[model samples]
Target chain A: MSYSSQAIAKPYFTVAITLFAVQVLFGLIIGMQYVAINIEGIMFDTARLIHTNLLIIWLLFGFMGASYYIVPEEAEQELYNPKLAIQSLWLFLALTIITVLGYLLLPYATFAKITGNQFFPTMGREYLEQPTIIKLGIFAVLCAFTYNISMTILHGRKTIINLLLLTGIAGSTIVFIFAFYNSSNLVVAKYYRWWLIHFWFEGTWELIMEAILAYIIFKVTGNREIVEKWLYIIVAVTLTTVILGIGHHYYWIGVPEYWQWIGTLFSVFELLPFFFMLLFVFNVVNCTKCHSSNKALKLWALSTPIMAFLGAGVLGFLHTLAPINYYSHGTQITSAHGHLAFYSTYVMIVLAIISYTMPILQNNINNRIVQKLEILAFWLMTVSMSFMVLFIAVAGIMQVYIQRATDLALPFIEIQNSMMILYWLRGAGGLVFFIGVIIYIIGFFYNRHLAVD
Target chain B: MKILTKPKYIYYSSLIIFICLLLGLTIHTIIVLPERDHRDNLTPQIIQGKMVWEENNCIGCHTLLGEGAYFAPELGNIYKRRGGSHGGAYFIKAWLKAMPTNIPGRRQMPQFNLTDEELHALIAFLKWTSEINTSSWPPSEKG
Candidate 1:
């Protein structure tokens, strides 16, 4: 490794992979619950809380690992504070364990009361449901992270990729302060929730995801100018669409009349960024002589754009227009979009960066068994998740037809009852997905054992 | 040539322009929220009800404003559908009281054991929610 501190990424990746396994297990439980397959202990809500919370936390770990690994090489220096980085990792992980236990053991309401939700009023809004204390702890963890990364960047050489990554980390951190805002008006509360959520997904998160992808492309192809050029274009296009296109969400949320037209016109263009990402990855890889001997670099690198285009671009556009979203806003269609878009863009990008850098960290570029397993894991997870999204989307379309659009309107319960079969297929897909994640985690450990031998 | 040679400058400038536009739109959106969301109707009981809603984690199972887990039916307009516009408070109270209907296989709701005061307050909050202009959502009362 170029820098001794790069080894810190190993532990972050290890923790992220472990939590990802836990997340998929919860996902399996929730999927089964949807089809009445008998989760005796955990309720759907509780399982969902664990599943989504773990997903967000683990993905954050992935980002931290990516930054820890990438920033040093880009800067040509050791990390600013590797010790503090390790401490923050442990601190954040420990707090997460306690918070999750609180979710499982305590009555959520009582837990909220004791954790000062009454004062902050930020508990139980999907994804931002952590108690005020834990949210504050998370803020502290992110602040430490931002400080470390910012100092590292300031002290060393700067590039567009590094600068964009910093802006993302800092911008998202700043917007998170908005989550503590509480509004008695449900409309306004929902409104700003998007401010926190959409900005992360489309704005800050997009920047981070693309910048990392740029780093990967440079690693694989040794085309710094091309990578930077594509990254700059993608970021500019993404921000315009992401910032203005938030109107798509505003359409149904009691916002305003103008958003229907405004949201539609802008959100439709959200496709451009993903399309460009797909095109950029292919053009860079295909046109350049790939410099890496890591057999799997191509797999991780190419798969992200292909899936991002399919999941985030095509599938997202399927329901992004105001007319279609009016019918499918909260249905399984949105769930389907969420699963694929998130898995394809954020989740896959994290895995891409992890797979790309982890080999360098170990100083072993070619591990045959690990490469095979990664491919197996890749195909299994992507195929099963694709099927999962398909089933969920079909269920959503059926729901719209039977419940909303059809003249013979069925009640919500009956519509759900009629859609049991799709839920069963979705459950089966979740099982496969869970297996893929488990296999992915086991592949890493198996490599470590071989390294020791 | 500039697109290739100096893409970074274009990137930063375009971001600034769009961000300014977003800020302007956000201000306009805020100025209109009070009228659209009916801020005058946010009574103490309604606000208290909102707190109770958060405390109970109602959004964990049910969607208010179509923004939560989809485990339960949409309740943003529950006041209109179940409360019959005039008697929404009573219907909501009774519904909250009845839990775990023991339907053999159906997903059961946990009884929150809310007091009468909490129940009334929750209903008031929902009533306020229902009156907000959603520009026609759920497409039908089936939500």
Candidate 2:
């Protein structure tokens, strides 16, 4: 908010939250379809594609918004090019809209053909399904974004946080080049895909998350030395553990058997950074004399590390071992882990930053009513998502037992039918989550007439 | 304060240890592990079949080698299940040709209306996939 260029982040944050609401709506639809059984026309796969794609796109939007806001402040400069940032935002939103509409309207194959996927043929493979042209467009956008941020850093203070964030952004962009490497060899294809997925999430994204969290803690506690020291340790652990953690996905893919041992042993260490994050946040909060009146931000800041530990750290360990994963692979257990991990780690961090920055950007302390509603939204979203995680974990455990563990194994459909009640419960949780999102959005516009603090 | 003021060597050494461990493990996984023999012999038809699978977005519904969606049964071992004792590619082709049984009140796969050539290629792809070492995944043929 110190720089006029930072205001460009406002549109990105607004759109990100809006898409988050849309993602939750799709979650409810898919959750309902799980139990209803008779709901037709919209296949579970179709809903799932939308759900997963929106999750990725919206999170990207959130990250970009965060970069726009954080990079300038850390660099002590205006954005390198605010106009380019705005253009990138619009282009990204437009492409996302067109891509989503295509997914909904046309058969995936026809859509692929229409998007010139036949030329390179990188359509199906999970999460990297965007057409080759769109992928190129994304690459272009990322280059522009990286250039803008990097130039600003070059012109101004090059703090560790900025350097780390830049490394993450640049590293992820480079890793994405492998998305186009859709070899016919599934093993080779999966190997490259993890270079994008695992490296981004566990490797680079952790650096980005840590940098941002460090920024927030510094702002709150004015403890630069302590925060920066923790940041270094966290990044070190992350780089060490997550690089090898990619082996976990290699275990079941057509890779060699050694990945079984390597994946499990390395993945066990992947939880350390998240655990350190929990300690970092709480320690900062405890030592700080200055309690920034933004209780909502403080709440989000605190929730992130704790929830991330439970979701990504503890639950990830539960299935990281090869023996357990053999049964849990591709089951709802992964889904449960995924839901909590992304929510706690990535989603909460984004929301936390937005909550902290939005008030400053508006040049006001939020009115009491707005603050109260925002806190309410926080509880509603966090509690309901936790419930969603619990219900899905229970569903996953039951599925593993009945479908894989038991002497008399059940068919997938029969087991799915037996888990209808849990699906219903999950759907209920989704409904509550949707309500929380709506409340969170409404809190933004409420009390607009009140005077600024 | 003492913890924060500790010499930088401890931190640097910890980082060094981490990098060494990661590099060692990565090399073991990528190079030391021998390649499965079947992978070195992929034919043009099998490659084409994999393209067909990707183009059609079959992974949206089916799990291949315990990857992809779990909405449908795992197809990584479909050849073993359909072929029974002797793994034949014919059953897979037949099954693909006769999809979307449109059964009442059950999940159904939409028919892609693949050409004969595409079907052949897809079956070949499945056959090749079945032969690759997946570390004995899917737990059983029930997948």
Candidate 3:
């Protein structure tokens, strides 16, 4: 039961938080750019690259940090070498910074300045589409973390949590393996990229999410039996989704027509785990009966899984039906699905871990009022972000009906102009969410002051 | 005495049921699939036309049969919709070759600088697409 302040895991968590903060800033910029297209186009491209790439880096860092923190405890042995873990963290941070800088400088490069001649013709014009180098960097980082963590797990302890962790690691490995493939054929490369993208989301992240939910339940209630049962259910549901749910991504890809039916059907059932996550989070937290005491933890515990359902499960289901998605696949509705679901599963995991650690770092902060305020900030941020997504999704549906279904020969400018109100709403929602972030950061430092180690 | 819970065959049966559902779906798709014509059955002229269409990623801009990005008009019903003896193959070919030269503010379709052979092939592909039975899709004579 000994806890050390000098743990190497600390720096990983620090880097993760720093990356997340940068991600949030880029997210805000992206949200704002949608509101006004005239606002410096440079900002627009920068935000897009940062917002997307930061999601990859921050989630990877957070998951790695969480693993470093928990792996030793589950294994009943200290980390294989704390020094190696620290070195991996530094290597990852350096690689991510270099990659982000490269992406930002892309617009200014001589290649970009060239006209008629394709800039980075080998890779597409879009920075996001410049997947080769970015994917390679990410794959290296994933391998480093996976190897170190796998070695730790093998030499140390075995727990149900370890099994879940191993599954996620395996999934990450598969995702990286797909990154190396560059067929001479252009059509084949695009097809394989989706395997890495969609599979990582529906497959690997599912395992990580299940493990986190189980970990939270166990930690909050000190109930092993319940956690074990829930883990079994989560694992079963995740596997079901992973194997079949990839069809959802295949619909628009010229893969095969049959995948549409398979994707829609399996994705419909994919909502089951999310439903269970919702019930499991709330029901378990409620069962604890810790009346308003540990309110922040309770809210943190409840919201992570609940948002997963509301955002990923319910909202995801709305447009995922093949009939509905046939029109909305590449539209803003898909963006809404991505923003909310990624925020829920990945962002909320990081938030949950932060919530868990905050109290531990500051054991003296028994003030229920402050915890409640933090909880309120959590709700404010979560609700505003989710509402932003919902508004955009509605805007997307409108765009689809007007622009796609009907033949108005309506100009894209007119449609874009019409969608400004939704963008404004999204910006307002982002402002409220940002305000919550400010409050939470303030609370974090205040709590830190009281529990300065 | 600890009571041993019997293994529920029903649990396993549900897995079997799930598999059956997927299998049934697969079978339904195969059975209902339209018999596809061979690439050779398509005239070499038409095949070449399709290759031209693909090389320029025309489908990336204009959808046929409700596929591809909707950045441009649905070319699926273009022949019938544009209507007139003038809207025949010759006119279509001329319009594509000299696209955006006439219409202002129109998204200028990039000139691919195709040879006459390539141009004829593209027209063949467009004609082939126009002939597909779309069951009154586009929903207008002038889409």
Candidate 4:
């Protein structure tokens, strides 16, 4: 690592990758449960709770890791306070561990009771299920992280990437506080919940992702001006589209009818950014004629936007309209889109950065064993996930036809039962994905000069 | 592309303008939300039931508003599908009381041992949820 503070990303990456592994393991169990493999105590719900929560946590840690590594290098300076950053990370980890353990050891209701949820009542929201205390801890950690990054940028060279990343971090940190404002009215609760969900996932998080992608593309292509140029366009398209695109979610969620038009019209442009992003990556690579021997980095760098386009752009567009989504909203189509979107958008970017940084941090390049494993892992994950998404999509289509579109609709249980074959196929894909994760994890350790977990 | 490459201030200004416009729309949302959701109908019992639903993390298995886990049927409309149509609150109560059918190779729900009071509250919650203005989602009762 160039700066001493950058080395702290090691623990952050460790937490991220480890949590990613367990998240997929839980995902595997959830897949099996769909195909009649009964996991008693954990069940489908609890396993899902753990799975989704782990995903959000690991991605957050990955973002933190990326910010820590990118800031000092971009700023041409060390961190504002290495000691405080380290302390903040430790506290963040401790609180997250406690939250995960609580989700496991204690029953849902029991855990809520113990955490004094009645006082604030923030527990059990989707993706925001952490206890009230854990929520406060998360806010504190975010404040520390935001302050650290902001101060670092303030003290050093402030580039476009640095400014955008700061805006994203600060915006998401602010959005998260909405989780604490609970309302007894379900519609009110769901209404404001989208402010956090849509704003972060589509708006702010894209800023962070684009900044990181631009950083990598520029590093590889040595084309700062071009990369920065495309970065602004991608970001501009993303916000203008996604800001109004939040209406797509509001359409059927007890919101006003104006959303029906507003959501659809705006979401039509949602594909622009992902498309532009794909173009940006390839244009830079071609412009610079990248002949890097780091095949793994090349693989991750290219796949990041391609898969994001497929997942978040195209698949998302399929259901973005109100009429189509009316049938597909709660079905497996959403699951299909959600899985691919999350995997490609956040997970792949994180992996891309890790692959690029870890070797350099440990002062090694292109270890044959690590190279082969990551490439193989990349293909395995991509192919299996594509299979998984396809099966789920087919099942979702069939489900819509049989369960919703038909004159005589079948019951939910019967429709689910009919999709056993697709469920089995999805489970198979999950098994392969689990193996891919294990392989990826093993590659991290095989580096001879390994310094980070 | 040339304009984009020339000045960063232009891009920053556009972002700020878009955000301000979105905020303007959000105020309209805030104004209409209380009426659109029929916030006045959210009774104390319904609120209590909501707390119970959350406390148990019901969203873990059952989707409330086309959101949450898809393992179970959407519970948001349960009040209309079962209660208002045929079965009513009694059926919901029996279903809750019936813990883990113990059917081999079938997904199971844990028994929460909810009190009679909680059961009534949960029914009230579902009833309120059914009445929300979801713009007619799910296409059919299959949800």
Candidate 5:
């Protein structure tokens, strides 16, 4: 909130939390559908489309907001073209709303026809299902965002954190351009799709997270040099592991068989950064005199790396081996990994940044009640998501055993039927997670009137 | 004592080594491993079938190449299972036409009302996909 440009992030963060709540709602719908509740007209597939797309969009918003907030502060300058920033935000939000409504209201095929998907035909590719027009819109918005942030950095001081963040944003934008390159060859299409997905999450986004975590560590501990050095090491390790780790997705795709060995070897080391992140956070926190009064922010920063390691690192490792992934691929195990990895790595980090910055925007003098609510929300969400992951993992294991492992292989439907209890448990977990998100939103708005008064 | 006190060189060298290793791996994956013959031999019908699959959002329910929703069985190997020794392209074509068996209490696939041409193309695409080297996936034909 130091510069007027930083205020642009407030709306973005608000929108992010709002979409997050919507995502959880859709997640609950899908969860219910998992347990045999059939809502008329709204298929589980449709709910899934909404849920996954919203998750990606909301996280993009979070990342954009975080960049807007962090870049100005780290670079020690006002944003370049705050007006353009706000305009792009609105356009992005509008497009998201329109796209989501289309997904909900129209049948998938009908929606595809109306969206002019026949021209480019990039629908139904997991997570890249946005119409060509919408994809173009996203590209346009990201280019504008990159320009704004790049200009700000160029005009001001350049630090390791700012440089790393810019690299991430730029790298992701460049990789995303390939989303338009949908080839007829399924192998080629799947190969390039991972260029966006794996490169974003495991590759560039990790750099962004590292930069943000470093910024937070510096803010809290006032140890710039130590944070920078650690960030360098972390980035080095990340580059070493993640670039080759893209092979993990290649193992089951129509790629060559050599990917089995390459994928396993590299993906095994993908856990190092998360593990390093956990260590880095704890080391910084332990050494610091605790400058920030926001204990909730500290809690978030601490938990992010820990949960990231457990979710993205441990759970990811459990199935990353090509042999095990052979059985677990496309099962509930994948869902379990996805849930924990995204929540721990992306969701938690975004909330951590929001937790740190929101109070500054509001100029809250006393945030005791808000802090307590946030902590409660944090624990509730973390515990519930963990339970969700556990339930899904058990279900996935059962599926692997019953459907894939034994000589008496059961059909997919029979296994799914036997896993109804786990789905119900997962649905209950989703309910708790939604409640936690509601509490988080409440915490954001709490005492705002008092602050204004 | 000086080396221990200032490890900047070590850090920089490690980073350089890591980047080189990454570049090496990327080149290997991009240039070496992908099967050129299969990619080159993809037919127009198979390409159209892939487009049809994308347009219809089939991956929304079915897993293909171990990607996509797990609600339905994996279709990456469906051609092998349905059109291999025991079955043929006719079986797959019939299966698509007869979807949504509505077998009470089972997950049902929506009938997309695909044209005969579209069905033929889709079967061709699945057959093409089945021939690609998936590094031994699905664990069994049960996929």
Candidate 6:
């Protein structure tokens, strides 16, 4: 009942840590599958969908936990109810379990029945075979999360940042609902599906980025005024960017002709919030005169916002233009952007929160060592993931060039087969990133006994 | 005493720079948009072909003048892209008439069963699209 240091943060920490590990591990398997012919007797085609989907689910869970921990702090009140929070968590957990089980059980059989004309082992089926029910389950879970977060925010104090956060969550809810209707009709459904995916990427996720960056800035600098200013800038810029930035996804789809111009124009502006975020965080860190904290911790906290901005913002800019994206859409190049921008901004923010809170819970060890290790892990993983994305993008570009050069149609399989070198380089990058994840995981648990008072 | 740590000027300056960049980019795009080009001689065949294309949803599967779904290749310059007019009206007519050809592992294009007259009209529609001044999309003849 007390809002003191005795509050149990261990469970949240445990969930975050476990999800991070699972994400990194699956990420590595997906990476290796790119290069290796037969890893665990599964095709790369089937493995990748699972890998990306799993990464998205786990990361979303981590983000939810981070938000749950922070909203109460910002409000200067205990969570509206810990029981409700736990209830939300259980619903998400149940839904995820059911979905995964269905994916493993029903999907393979369906794939075999449809394509292979026979039954096969359940665990070995292609990912696309999963029933539409799994998608429905995911939508339900998203609704539950939206309701919990909305109710919590309603009862708690409302700041600009929290309100923006609520908006992002609300947008996510709408997008999820839209996603459920995606298979009803191909023409309208395809447009709406892009609305969910593209809007989530270019719109609501932009707001989510702002909220995370604001929280990180507040924790690190203790300058609420500065944080608030940047938050406004981020939200304003992101809204403008996403509303039109959606044109980027529209280019390939059978959308209206004018969307190409609109998407390209807005995407260019999307870089603005990112640039502001970088300037804001670095300026804050530079102005700080205190050295009482670990240099490693300080650096990690200082760098998270900036990196998120770069990963999602600058790298995202590389192929978003209509001219370049016309060639690169649905290729490995787009995948590269998603890998870096999504992981860097969202994943780092979650970890940054974990780094901040676990210490407050128990400061029995030196902060510097943990901070240093965390920073080290951050760079190691980020660089590797960046390499994986870039290599694949280049390969994709090369494939497109070669493919279009021939008047005769080339097989998609042949294109994939020829890009073995790029795949290996990508796999190598994943391995390096996994190594970093292991380092971070070790540092996380070790800090339990090792924080300084 | 307190140390004068806050740089009010720098924050304001940073804000100014961001605003300038936005205005600059928007203006640049407007300036770079290609001037609209018009074609003379409104032929009946071309008009009829365009009607055929629209009614059959050719734009759903193919891009022409960079103004359609990209599910298929850009046919805006297909006359030159195929290294001959071989892929023009006659070739397109045949292709649409017997699409999907039972080719395994290839995306099947739908057969519209357009009459010879309609096929010729659709071909004329595509040829007309190819003739439009698009300032060179796909960046190559083969595209």
The superposed Cα distance between candidate 5 and the true structure at residue B1, in angstroms, equals 19
Best by lDDT: 4
Better candidate by lDDT, 1 or 2: 1
Is model 4 an incorrect, acceptable, medium or high docking prediction? medium
DockQ of 5: 0.54
- How does residue A452 of candidate 3 score in lDDT? 51
Runs in model 1 lying further than 4 Å from the true structure: B1-6
Candidates' TM-scores? 0.97, 0.94, 0.75, 0.97, 0.95, 0.71
lDDT (tens digit, per residue) of candidate 5 on A1-453: 678799888899999999999999999988888877788898878888999999999999999999999999989999989999999999999999988998899888888899898888777799988888999999999999999999999999888899889988998899898889887778778888888888998888888888888888888899988788788778878877887788788877765677788889988898899888888989888987888888899899988999999999999987899888988999989999999999998999999999888888778843898999899999999999999999999999999999889998987877898998998999999999999999998988674444552
Expressed as tens digits, the lDDT of each residue in A31-98 for candidate 2 is 87777654556766667777888898888888888999999988999999999999999888888888
Better of 4 and 5 by DockQ: 4
Question: What digit string (tens of lDDT, one per residue) describes model 4 on residues A1-453?
Answer: 778889877778888898999999999999999988865567677788889989988898999999999999999999998887789878988987898788888898999999999899998889988899998998998898899999999999998888889988998899998989888878778878888889888988888999988888888887788887888788778877887888888877887898888888888899899999999998789768775678999999999999999999999988888888889888889899999999889899999998888887777777888999999999999899999999999999998899889899987777788899999999999999999999998887676346443
Cα deviation of A339 in candidate 5 (Å)?
Answer: 0.4
Question: Which residue segments of model 2 deviate by more than 4 Å?
Answer: A37-40, A447-453, B1-34, B84-88
DockQ-based class of model 1: medium
Q: Please report, in order, the local distance difference test score of every candidate based on alpha carbons.
A: 0.86, 0.82, 0.64, 0.87, 0.86, 0.60
Off by over 4 Å in 6: A1-10, A109-137, A288-296, A363-369, A405-411, A415-417, A448-453, B1-143
Interface RMSD of 6: 12.4
Can you write out model 5's per-residue Cα lDDT over B1-143, one digit (the tens) per residue?
A: 34333444554576578657756766766675447327666788988899889988888888898899877888888888775746758898888889879887788778889999999898888888887777677787788
CAPRI-wise, candidate 5 is medium
Give the residue spans of candidate 4 off by over 4 A.
Answer: A448-453, B1-9
Q: Which pairs of residues collide in candidate 3?
A: A75-A157, B49-B121
Q: Write the per-residue lDDT of candidate 3 for residues A77-149, one digit (tens) a residue.
A: 7777677677777788887786566556544222222321131222331122334445555666677677777
Computed on C-alphas against the true complex, the DockQ of each candidate is: 0.74, 0.50, 0.08, 0.73, 0.54, 0.05
Question: Residue A406 of model 1: what lDDT?
Answer: 74
Give the proportion of true interface contacts each model preserves, from 0 to 1: 0.72, 0.57, 0.00, 0.78, 0.66, 0.02
Using lDDT, rank the candidates from best to worst: 4, 5, 1, 2, 3, 6
